[model samples]
Target: MIHFDMSIFIVAAFLVFTLLVGICFSRQKTTFREYAVGNKQFTTATLVFTVLATLYGGGGLVRNVEYVYRIGLWWIVIMLLSSFGLWAVGRLALRMGPFMQHFSMAETIGNILW
Candidate 1:
């Protein structure tokens, strides 16, 4: 069996490797386009995962898990409601990229309101 020290060292090494990977992907940006979207190109899978994280990265998952534990199968209603909300917003959010073409969310909102 692996010793505790070995397990800790393995976990630390994995974290360092992930940090290095993120650093290596960092880019020098001079243009708004490069700054808004990174200079490094992301493939379809990366984009999909990025979108998923953006949509659900908060305590949504944890809250849903708790709801499931406490209320059992009725959690499906909560999950479905959340999914439906996303689906409703998804179209506007998608068009947002091209419609306003703003580099930031604050900029987009300001533009929409003003």
Candidate 2:
């Protein structure tokens, strides 16, 4: 006899659904422009949120928390400085986007040097 648990079934169904969605999306090839700038229709608020997530996602927030816990307020100051640096780089990239067009970052740098 097989036993079925409702909680386990729900989790398994969700995992399968997510796996299918990933597989479906993975089958499509992203063009260089789409890969570089994404959909390009993101509003200012969306762009801000995306940038914030990119900057602080992955283990970045965790590492920042650890640094603050270990080193105190100065760690937050350092993070603020780095965030400002990221903003400057983003601004520079926006200015350079027209020149680079659909080029990847590595390709853009190569074109500049070579």
Candidate 3:
């Protein structure tokens, strides 16, 4: 008797489930501003976790774990760059400055609405 490996199947199933959930909640008719900054649906905790995740890349995460396991609490210095990068991206992603647009977000942005 031969046994079959289903690891790939399990991963694919999980990915499909997650994608379905994302598709279900994602808005189809969102404007440029709304799509960029969201509708303020995120809680403070959620925002914090998102920022943390974005700031700490995969390498940083693994390195931090390794650092903690090997040395002491010194690798925290890496957080400075991460936090700065997150701040910059967050500002750009959230703050919408005045730009050339003769119509609404839906009608002007990407020209899909226009």
Candidate 4:
């Protein structure tokens, strides 16, 4: 059987590699377009994981797991409902914020392009 230390080392190495890859791409040429955006050329898979982590936080997952443990396995529905509610609210506010004000709470979500 594989030892626990081996597994931990492999996971740590993989994380270091991933961090290097993302950081290597963070710096790029500076211009009105490049400087404003700062080279956000992420792959779709990376984008998916990034969005998932941001939208469904650690607290939400912890709560859902706790609910499932107490309620005996049907709490996934509650988790889904809560996630959907948050997504709906964000979508509505973002879709409306641009028209209402120059700098909305939704603007906080966007790039400042400085």
Root mean square deviation (Cα) for candidate 1 = 5.2
lDDT, candidate 1, equals: 0.77
Model 4, CA-based lDDT: 0.70
lDDT of 3 by residue, 16-106 (tens): 9999989987856778656666655689999888877876779978988898777655556655555786578778866454433334566
In model 3, where do residues sit more than 4 Å from their true spots?
1-3, 15-34, 65-114
Candidate 1 per-residue lDDT, tens place, 9-42, comes to 9899999999998787665435768767765588
Report the number of the highest-TM-score candidate. Answer: 2
The TM-score between candidate 1 and the true structure equals: 0.53
The numbered model that scores best in lDDT is 2
lDDT of 2 by residue, 18-80 (tens): 999999999999986777687576799997898889878969888988999999999988877
TM-score of 2: 0.57
State candidate 4's TM-score: 0.41
The TM-scores of all predictions, comma-separated, are: 0.53, 0.57, 0.44, 0.41
lDDT of each: 0.77, 0.82, 0.70, 0.70
C-alpha lDDT (0 to 100) for residue 71 of candidate 1: 96
Worst 10 contiguous positions by lDDT, candidate 1: 95-104
